[model samples]
Target: MNRKLLVLPAVMGLAAPVLAGCGDSNAGSGGGDSIVIGTTDHIAVSKELPSPVDPATSYDGGTYTFFNNTFQMLLGYERSATIPSPDAAKSCEFSDTKSETYRCTLRDGLTFSNGHALTSEDVKFSIDRVIKIKSDYGPVSLLSNIQSVEAPDDKTVVFHLKASDATFPYKLATPAAAIVDSEVYPADKPLDGLQMVGSGPYKLDSWDGDKAVLSANPNYKGLVGKLNNSKVEVRFFETAADMEKALADGGIDMVNRTFTSDQIAGIQQGKEPNIKLTEASSPSVRYMFFNVDDPTVKDKAVREAIARLVDRDALTRDVTHRTATPLFGAVPTGIVGHSNAYFNTYGQPSRDKAAGALSAAGISTPVKLTFSYPTDRPATPNKEEAVALQKQLNGSGLFDVTLKGMPWKKFLPGAVKGQWAMYDLSWLPDFPDPDTYIAPFFAEGFLNLNYPGGDIKNSLLPSTRQTADRGQTDKDFLQMQDILARDLPVIPLYQDKQYVTTRDNITGAEWLLNSSSTAQFWELGRGVAG
Candidate 1:
């Protein structure tokens, strides 16, 4: 019953890699039962991604959603659920009291969509490949606890951990550990392009850059006993409005990913009579990270000064239109480890306080800085927020800020290279755990802050992971958030209020979430409206 948390924490805007040549806009034959889902969030295909949908190297939640449905994992969450249950494996459990040894037995008759026999070896290959490839943007860090993976026989696999990590099962359920066919995937590199070979609930019938069609995989032998619908079609558009138009025109049956703040406001007003609304008290969050490598921001004083001056009230109320609440910790509100570290340290936005910070460090006035955000992010007010943030920082006279808008493709690479001084990033948990939120900052250098996460990474993070009891992690998580607050490597902005809109006739829209508690593509089906 625990859930939430992610790799590419999401893809409200970023498409790291996806299927190429999805081919044709035509829907597959499912009669009145066919369902089409639309999003401003694009699904895959990028020059940046070496493997289009290789689970080991892939990071986007959108990609995870697609892959989770297509690729089998040793464990998986049931529909509308959080805790991972047996999917590829018949059952999985820690074989030791220390949580260091985990073992699993595959279901009796498992096969990849290609009918290649699925085995413990595939499970071992899927995981070992991840740690080996170690993609900079991938979820390698999530598996840092595992020392080795062993397949004693065709049916059984065991994980030998470097240390006790209670959260390891949840990590296996993520796309990072998604099982790929050893026959199809390269041992050390990603399988190139649109070719995805798996034994999950659905087969990617087709995928073009803008649309993807999925159909039930009869070969699938784990998880759901049967599918709710036989086919699913995903339409990716350039904007939320375009997605909304598709929903209104009956081109798509459901709307997920994003609808701009204004569109959501109108939808909340009950203007879209045929569309149903469901709001999730979500754990989703977004933040702006400083590239500590950047000369201007390298000094902790400048970062702290700017952090003190920037306004969150304006961002939540004016920019996001209250669709989000101010977030003060890496762990957002509604998550188990939530804290108000930033708010506790800096009471509120104040230029005088910001001036004090810089003066204390002997840094001069009006520090020149370039701030950037993804211009391509959908349904979210990222660009507007960037503009607002630029003004807020500049207005304080503590900074002279310029704005740069990077499309999602260019955005991540530039971020990895520390191209922008500071840029915006968003996260959604692949599972509901503090590790999903905090571990990456240290394990993989995914944040690329250039600040070596000394004690937080090597000590606090390991300490938190060593226990299965999430409640016991509260104090440690708080301390970690406080350290982040003091260091100002990344500034918490706001946590989201997620909304999914479905056409009046659609069923199971309320159950749709692409991230942690992942949408069971099979759970969606045609039914009489309530």
Candidate 2:
């Protein structure tokens, strides 16, 4: 659900609305202090979103954060853990050795927000709607293995797959496979607007276009675990400055994203007495992709040449101020199947090497191409990242590059249609696995490079997905990473480090993000109650 860019009003610079009708002003330690989180990460990368709340079409991280708390699934990722734990289901497993029939049993006495039964039928309806709609902005690809679904009983749901896939549970653990209320959500269409009705940990109390208020759902009977703060609010800020100011002014209890380098440095140096910072090696990765269908980049040598000239270390150090680290492959470090394939093959940036590769392929010097990036992600440094990228490639004197920035609405669709010759995009895994890093970009190309992934998709990907033991498939992933490096369809720029800064008194800040870097607002607490 990433490439979680930015939403319309949020991207268009909507001001963060203050909390309404709240009695507590204490943002620090104390019982009943309502936890408020501030961030500039309210980005959604959807095309047909009349409202960016539908689980089917809303495939961005910001929306996924919202979905995780409101809509329950059969399985969910444990905090900082990859293995799926039971959520709505009391038990879930493949019924046959073929790994084709996935079955789950709902917990007893489950019900929706309106007291309607939360049955296997609702689960079947929700998943079927996603498949039938097949929105370009949705996670339809993740569930492509499903041949059909059945509600054998009110409490039991069965999924029949087109092929044997042991990783089915991992895919289902994500919010993409969210279970919605059949009575509320339309069968053939997405539920329009931000109206949420599901059985999860939190209920959407109110959304004033900027801040969304969430309260503990009394009807929720899932695996969301214990709630630290019973009530929480997610406040979207227009800029990093606004977010930091809100945190400093006690308007919010924590800051999730877009903090300036100076602010981060100051906090790390212990300059802020009231602040506490928690960080982790992040799974989020950003890279440059080439549309192989584009005539300018059709040649493999041309693609490989650009990869050689990219200065990743400088991009991370100067632009992001080393908040991020240079990445050599699609899968980041700490993940199971990570490899330094690009670094192994191309080494560091070299103008001579790039030029030599191009000349050897009989491609003329001073190749002309357009480098595209998104302008809609105002909260992020898209422009700076793009300008720096252009300098790396064009300043080589072997290429003449023109820089272009389009809003995400126009940019994403064009990218999916294979319109851009070269563009920069960011990614966070739909699930914490190597296939997430490789397959989405390769199989028909999520960046829609219009390149049939050839061996990677046809051979390697299917082979890797055949087993549940993710560690055993490292060899296949290693080869896939090698092929990506050899072909040079995309170049990995950097992987970010997750940072969540909260008031010193706030507890459980480290558990704010799960294994996939999805936000878990339920983890934060202020003080123990009587």
- Once fitted onto the true fold, the runs of candidate 1 whose alpha carbons sit more than 4 angstroms away are 1-32, 514-517, 528-530
Q: lDDT tens digits, residues 1-530, model 2?
A: 23211110111111111111111111122236678988676643234557578888877777788888888888876565566767888878888877788888878888876778899999999999999988887888888889999999998999999887767887887777898899999988887777888888888998877888988887877666467778888898877777877887788899766576557877899877798877666778888888887899999889989889988899988777887899998777777668899999999889999999999999998999998888856446788888887888888899989988887778878887888999878788887677788877897355687767889988888887676667777789889889988887888988876677898878777777777677777778876431
TM-score to true structure, per model: 0.91, 0.91
lDDT of 1 by residue, 1-530 (tens): 01132221311211111111111121122335668888676757567775767777767656777887898887776544445677787778888887889888888788888889999999899889988998877778778778999999999899999887878888888888888898889889878777788988888888887888888887887766656678888888987877888888888888757688888889899877798877776777888888887898999999888788878899988898998889889997655677999999988998899999899999998899888777777766878988899889888888899888878788877877667789877777767777778877655576677878877878988887677666677788899899999988889898877777788877766655534746666656678331
Clashing pairs in 2: 5-43, 6-43, 6-44
Backbone clashes in candidate 2 total 3
lDDT of 1: 0.76
Give the number of the best model, judged by lDDT.
Answer: 2
Q: Score residue 482 of candidate 1 by CA lDDT.
A: 92
